[model samples]
Target: MTTDSGTRTPIRWGVLATGRIAESFASDLALVDGNELAAVGSRSPEAARTFAERFGGSRAHGSYEELAADPDVDVIYVATPHSRHLEDVMMCFEAGKAVLCEKALTMNLADAEKLVAEARSRGLFFAEAMWMRANPNIRRIAELSADGTLGTIGQVRAQLGFVGPAATARLWDPMLGASGLLDVGIYPLTFAHLILGEPVSITAGGTLSDQGIDVNGGATMTYASGAVASIAWTQVAHSDNRASVAGDVGLIEVPARFHHPTMFTHWHDDQLDTISEPVTGRGYAHEIEEVAACLRAGKTESALLPLDDTVAIMGQIETILDQLGVAAR
Candidate 1:
């Protein structure tokens, strides 16, 4: 079930970084048929070798350059940090490889726009790896919301927070584009946007760290139709991590850990209906499928996880952080 050019053939995935997220992606990719882990590249030779051995990659390259130029690799998964995404993705695209970069696709909107434009000009398939967007339950919920299952959508609320180790590099480092707003808060923001579309007006305010990183923050977005969304996120303390969509007729409640929730409740007046959905293979496979499907079909972007949506999401993050007086570096 492969083609001559190889890019349209069964996917041979190359990972650009040997990080925790990269390892998770490779683990889930194994569940996908018609796909193979071709290679892994890392700045550290040992890290690349170790990742390939564990993740079933056939070859390990000590440098990213080698992986990018690999003819055997049809696509490269850029699993670097928020700050490094643009640089890493560009490397793959310059080498003519399709890319699936992780969420918070870039540090700011400017970089996101550049990446999108580059992908288009190069005629390469590109997608932001926002796995939640690919979830079946989330998709169903989006459909219901659009079809008026919840009536006139008035207000949506979502929050995600957890305790993190103080010494973790990503959490404490400003250069890594560290922000509670970008890292975890983007989930609440995107969840609202997916259901409600872009907001007409955005007003946000929150506290930032002494080092100028957003540790805890909140945002309020209003649509032209009078609907509103309230979002919250923090790494300083533990919260319920809940979400709800309220409308004139009813509301849908996504319980704890709403971003990756498995169950949700539909409330219509006195009636409460609980719906549960099963997930497949750590929830990463769905996003992978979207990428693989696009590449196979000669598509340059995914309808489910479009680059425009990714860029818009980052723009929203910039607006919120700016109003909150937090410098999004």
Candidate 2:
């Protein structure tokens, strides 16, 4: 059911890319009841037209500038590569449009700070599309931890990795802000931050490509709470992509894609309890709904994925990058 405002209208959305991730998000947006695809934009006019036609958008623009300028677009989803997020988001901000940009928010903390400051000064809605934070299961995990069901989380272990076919693809290109740490490693790092808070000490070891990007990296985060998190990310190997949160009482294991898993299990003593919640589409609808809900309530940030948390996460990323001797372009 669609949550109704006084006017009972769906939030209008403009998609700002034609990549695979963009298409996945657009397909999920269709499943959301209170959101409408108003437009799509791409560097290639034909790609934009095709995407708009398939997604039922009212217009397709050959350039992001036009899409951002379209008055009918209530919010813009910047789905471009991390290297281009700053440029794309600034253009939308210039047009007085709200934005939900893909994660890792930007190539580095400086850009993230700039974007957040601009959004604050302009009083415009802006969010890093960390879809996992907006997920129901992750929220449940947070709640369980808060309620002491986890009995004080002692450690968090998470890993995300995939074998990339293109050594020169965006995932492997440093010039394009392609690295396992930012692209995939952030998942485990963010998950650790979410559960264990900021760590006091960080150590990272990784194999760097000729382009100076991390192909595989592992980090150990030691928090002030005495809790430890071992997180790893890679583009050269296939991992289970699972996560485990260990506490005094027991542990919670997320099967796969721990970031967006359908179900998780809690092992307490001799009992193994499972919680399952199926999501529709690709699970992107959850975040889309969150953005619409915030906009309708006239909030500049999401309660779930707050701006402060985003900044803190970016800071953690910076620390990790510095340790790895890698710099974002």
Candidate 1, TM-score vs. the true structure?
A: 0.96
lDDT of 2 at 152: 80
Task: Put down candidate 2 lDDT per residue, 1-329, tens digits, no spaces.
Answer: 13455567889999999999999999999999989999999999999999999999989999989999999999999999999999999999999999999998998888899999999999999999999987888888877776888898899999999998885489876768887888999899889988988889998888888888888999999998899999999989999899999999978999888999889998887799999877778889999999999998899988887877888888888888888888645
RMSD of candidate 1 to true structure, Å: 2.0
Compute the lDDT for candidate 2.
0.90
lDDT of 1 at 234: 93
| Best candidate according to TM-score | 2
| Number of backbone collisions per candidate | 0, 0
The superposed Cα distance between candidate 1 and the true structure at residue 324, in angstroms, equals 1.7
TM-score of each: 0.96, 0.96
lDDT of each: 0.88, 0.90
Collision pairs in model 2: none
Best prediction by lDDT = 2
* lDDT by residue (tens digit), candidate 1, 1-329: 36676543568899999888898899999998778899999999999999999999999999998999999998889888888988889989999998988888998889999999999999999998899899877887788789988899999999999876887879868988788987899999999999888999998878888898888888889999899999999989897899888888988989888887687889887899988787778888888888888887889999999788888899999899889887646
Q: Tell me how far the alpha carbon of residue 118 in candidate 1 is from the true structure, in angstroms, after superposition.
A: 0.5
